[model samples]
Target: MRILGIDPGLNTTGYGVLEINDRKLRLVEAGIIRSKPSGTLSERIQEIYDGVTEAIDSLKPEVLALEKLYAHYDRPTTAILMGHARGVICLAAAEHGIEVEDYAATQVKKTLTGNGRAPKTQMQLAIQHELNLANLPEPADVADALAIAFCHYCVWRGQRVANQSADP
Candidate 1:
């Protein structure tokens, strides 16, 4: 299966593509969709939509594993802004007929590092080790996106095995 993981943000939306075969993962491509701060809010949102749509068109992922947004009571504005970006990301997936899997940030972190509270640097290092890349994927968002993809792959692969044993 080919999976695309998204870490959506209004200014900088991150994406990572992965191919999973026989429960093993291979990195395809990873990068980000950036919106200009100078643009209006709607413009930023449109940027996210267009960029994500283009990525989905090119990468053609079977599933989009997106990070589910969690709102901190104290940071309602931040949460709302992130929701807008998340909407565009999911819309792109829907337009492409891609299945969507939502995972919590903590879930991805725990799946990658055995600690739900793992720090950003820890996530980056873990992803670097997992992909065996010569350099760590940077700016943190890219690594988070990859970790989300890896978590989705792990769950999907396990479910496949369980379903097989349950059949006949």
Candidate 2:
């Protein structure tokens, strides 16, 4: 199964495409979708929509695992801004006919590092070790995206196997 993971933001959204084949994980692609603060919010969203659409087209992932929208009481605007980016990401996924699942940041972190409050460096290292990458996925967001995908794998692996067995 191919899964696309997304960590959405208005300025810099991160993406990771992972494939589960024969019980192994492979990183097909990982990158960032950047929008400069100088651009209008509308333009940034459009750029995000375009970049994500391209990824969906090129990778053709079976489903998408997206981090759920989160906000701190002190910083409400962050959630509002991210809502725009998430909208476009989901829009692109819908257009491509891919199913979407939303996971909380804590859930993803716990799945990856066994701690809901694991640090960013730990998440990066975990992803690096999981994918056997020579270098850590950069800029934190990229690693976070990969973690989201890995979380889905951990949550669904057994169900997927059972379903496959039932099919035959």
Candidate 3:
């Protein structure tokens, strides 16, 4: 199964593709969709929408995983942009007939690092180790994207096991 994990942002939306089989993972691709800050809000959103749509087309993933937004009092503008990014992401997935799952930040970190409040570096290191990568994936955005993918893999595997046991 192939999964596409997205870290949404108006400035740089990050994405990572992972192929999984028998609990093993292989990184297919990882990158960010950058939008120029000089543009109007509408133009930036359009750029993000177009970039993410192109990624979905190229990857053709079986599942889509999105990092859920966690609010902070100091960053209302960040929260608003995050919402915009998420809107475009949902639209792209829906248009492609892909089921999207939104995982809370804690859920993803716990699944990856065994701790809900694990630091970003810990999550990044753990993901690198779990995926058997020699070096860390750069630009925290990419790391977060990969962690989202890993979280889905772990959760999906658990669900599959339960279903198999429930069946005759």
Candidate 4:
């Protein structure tokens, strides 16, 4: 199975791809999709859509795991703009027939670090240890994307085990 995790943003959308073979997870790719900082809203959206579509085409992930939208009362506009990025991402996944799963930031953190409020540094370390990487996953966005992907793996593994146990 291959899973693609995304941390969406207007200026810099991050994505990570993980491939599982015989229950071992491997990092296939991880990077960010950058829209021009000065581009118009529609132009930026188009850029993000194109970039993610290209990734899906090249990487061929089976599923997309996306960070769920979170809106703060003080910064509702941030969430609204993020919704645009996420919308295009989902559209790309749907166009390619890839299932999309949403995971909350807290849930991802808790699953990876055993703490719902784990700090960014801690999360980075957890991902590094899990993947046995030589260095920390740089540029927090990439680390975040990887964390989301691993969280889905953990959840999926648990469900698979439960199903097998229930099988007659």
Candidate 5:
């Protein structure tokens, strides 16, 4: 299974694609989509939509694992903008007919690090160790995106195998 993980933001939305083969996850691609703050909100959304569409086209992931909206009391503007970015990302995934699952930040971190309150560095290190990467993915967001994909793999694969067993 190929999965695309998204970390949505108006200024710099992060995305990573990974393929799961026989329970092993391999990183295919990872990057960030940046938008100008000076642009109109609608324009920023369009940019996000376009970037995500391109990612979908390139990666052709079977599923999309997205980070759910978590309220940030210190940054109301960021939260609102991230909501818009998330909409664009979800819309693109839906248009491509990929299954979408949202995971809370805590859930993702816990899945990756064995602790919900794990720090970013710990999560990044865990991802690097799991994926067997020579170096951690840069800019933090990419690592977060990869962590999201790994989290989905851990959570969703169990359910998938259960369904298959019940089927035959």
Candidate 6:
């Protein structure tokens, strides 16, 4: 199974693709989609949509995992804008016939690091070790994307195990 994880933002969206085979996970690709910093909102949205659509086409992932929206009282606007980015991403996935699964950011952190409130550096290290990468995943966003993907893998594996035990 191939999973694509996304950490969406207006300026820079991060994405990671992971392929799982017989319980082994391999990184297919990881990178960021950058919209022009000075572009209009509509232009930027279009750019993000296009970038994600391209990724979906090229990566051909079976599922897309996303971080659920979190809104802080002090920065409600940030969440609102992020909602725009997420909207286009979901649209792209739907267009490509890919299932989308979303997990809370805290849940992703806890699943990977044993702490729901793990710091960025800690999360990066955890992902690095899990993937057996030589260095920490860089720029935080990429690490976040991988964490979201890894979280889904953990949940999916657990469900599969539970089902197997229940069968006989």
Cα error of candidate 1 at position 66, Å = 1.1
TM-scores for all predictions: 0.95, 0.94, 0.94, 0.98, 0.91, 0.98
The list of candidate 3 runs beyond 4 A from truth reads: none
Give the per-residue lDDT digits (tens) of candidate 1, residues 41-99: 99999999998898888988999998876887999999998888888788888888898
Q: Evaluate all candidate structures by whole-model CA lDDT and list the values in order.
A: 0.90, 0.91, 0.89, 0.94, 0.89, 0.94
Writing each residue's lDDT as its tens digit, candidate 3 over 41-156 gives 88999998998899989999988999876787898888987898889889999999999987999999999888999998898799889888889888889899989988998899
Please, what are the lDDT tens digits per residue for candidate 6 over residues 17-75?
Answer: 99999889999999999999899989999999999999999999999999987777899
- Backbone clash pairs for candidate 2 read none
lDDT for residue 139 in candidate 6, whole number 0-100: 79
- The local lDDT score (0 to 100) that residue 59 gets in candidate 5 is 87
lDDT tens string, model 4, 1-168? 999999898999989999999989899999999999899999999999999999999999999999887787899998899899999999999999999999999999999989999999999999999988888998899999999999999989999999999999
The alpha-carbon lDDT assigned to residue 128 of candidate 5 equals 93
- Comparison by TM-score, 1 against 2, better one: 1
- CA shift of 155, model 3, Å: 0.8
TM-score of 1: 0.95
Q: Please identify model 1 stretches exceeding 4 Å from their true place.
A: none
Model 5, range 24-119, lDDT digits (tens) per residue?
779999999888889999999999899999999988999999887788999988788788888878899889998999899899998987799999
| Candidate 6 or 1, higher lDDT | 6
Question: Model 5: runs farther than 4 Å from truth?
Answer: 164-168
TM-score of 2: 0.94
| Deviation in Å, model 1, residue 164 alpha carbon | 2.5
What's the count of clashing pairs in each model shown? 0, 0, 0, 0, 0, 0
